[model samples]
Target: MQNTSHLLMIRPVKFSFNEQTAVNNAFQQNDTNNNVAEMAAREFDAFAQKLQANGVDVTIVEDTPEPYTPDSIFPNNWISFHEDGNIILYPMFAVNRRAERKPHVLKAIEKKFRIQNKIDLTALEANHQFLEGTGSMVLDRDHKIAYACLSPRTHMSALNNFAEKTGFTTVAFHANDRNGLPIYHTNVMMCVADQFVVVCMESITDENEKKLVRDAIHKTDKSIILISFHQMEHFAGNMLQVQNNRGEKLLIMSTQAYESLTADQIKILENYNRIIHSSLNTIETNGGGSARCMLAEVFLPVQQTQ
Candidate 1:
């Protein structure tokens, strides 16, 4: 299956704008208007409930309160599950984010799912190299391609290693924020769906790189939904497609992202799937990650019925 109905989300016990992550992620700010941790917990709880109400099977886990890892709610950045029964654990740039990769979580998941192989890329962090999982690279599963934009948090070496291990082609490009600094995460500017790709092509200043990325998407027979740098900044491209309980396709995004869409864009997307969104103002304001970043799809098949 290209998408999963099952999703894993962490309820933030201590969520806030991580000062450590803000070094690379300029989108985050330490502000009092959004009382950091309290607001995040409320938003996360609402977001999870919204997903579940939409018929999504969400596995909610409470984040440990002691360590105070603010970004723990966005679990997709730390781990990903594959259909081949493989699980890949990624190296996180933030010190607290590294703590999000707990063995107990995987063990808990193992009780319901079969994990054939486990690949750990956190070792790269020891060498000062990092790749923040789905945040760093958008995977085109059917085509076996990993679309990534080189940034401070996304290391090229780690991307290459992932490509080699997964037998995926890497389409790496440089993307910058409005101020021209490298964007912290690729998912913030792009998303790869089964038959479509939404991206901020303008972020790639290099003509050659932009063309290469465009050509790669075209080669996959996927329709390109282009979003301007301005739209991308509003988290328009940061969307995820998932299956609902009735086996229906649903595209999930933040309410901010939904409002940013044009009538034509919404119509085009609706042709592919149902759209589901929720108000994540506090989460987006503090965490600098939207709905897509919070979900880690479990593509592994369920155990057979007796």
Candidate 2:
């Protein structure tokens, strides 16, 4: 299946801004007066409810409070589940973020699906190289392509290694924000779905690189929906397309991101799938991620019961 009806979400116990990530992630803002954790929890619940209402099979797990994983809500940054029953663990740039990858979480998931083999790339962190799971690379699953933007959190070596392991062709490029700073995560600038791709063309400043990315998307036979850098700031490009139990396609995004889109853009997207948005202001404002980041699609095969 191109899109999965099953998804995994991590409910935050101590959701707050990460100082380590804030250094390069321009989207994050630290506000002292607000109760970030409380507000984030409310937002997470609402978002999960929204997904459920849209027919998504959301598996929500609460993060443990002991380790204080502030950005635990964004589970897509640490682990990715595959259809072939492979669970890949990624190396994170932040020290605290590494704690987000816990064995207990995998244990919880194993109760529902079969996890045949595991790939641990955490050893690369010792070399000061990191690849923050789906945050660093957006997979075009059907076409077997991995789109990655080079940054501190996404290195060439790591991308190549991931491709070698997963049998995905790597399309690497450098993407920058409006201010010319490298975009911290590839998913922040682009999202690849089954039938469409939403991207910030302006972020790929190099003309040759821009053409290469555009050409690659064309080869995938997906309709390209381009968002400007301004819209990208609102997390417009961070949207994800997924399927529900009824086999209906739904494009998910934050309310902030939905409000940023043009009427024409919305019309184009609606042609392919219904658009769903939930208010995630607190999480997006403080954690530097949105609806897509909170969801880790579960593609593992269900275990057969005799």
* Model 1, total clashes: 0
RMSD of each: 1.4, 0.9
Model 1 C-alpha RMSD to native: 1.4
lDDT of 2 by residue, 1-306 (tens): 568999999999888889989998999999684688898999899999999988999988889997878988999999999999999999899999999887778888998899999999989999988999999999999988999999999999988889899999999999998788999999988999888899998899999999999999999888888999889999998889999889999999999999999999999999999999999999999999998999999999987877
Identify the candidate with maximal TM-score.
2
Residue-by-residue lDDT tens digits, candidate 1, 152-210: 78899999999889998999999887799998999989988888999988888999999
Tell me model 1's lDDT, rounded to 2 decimals.
0.87
lDDT (Cα) of model 2: 0.91
Overall lDDT per candidate, in order of appearance: 0.87, 0.91
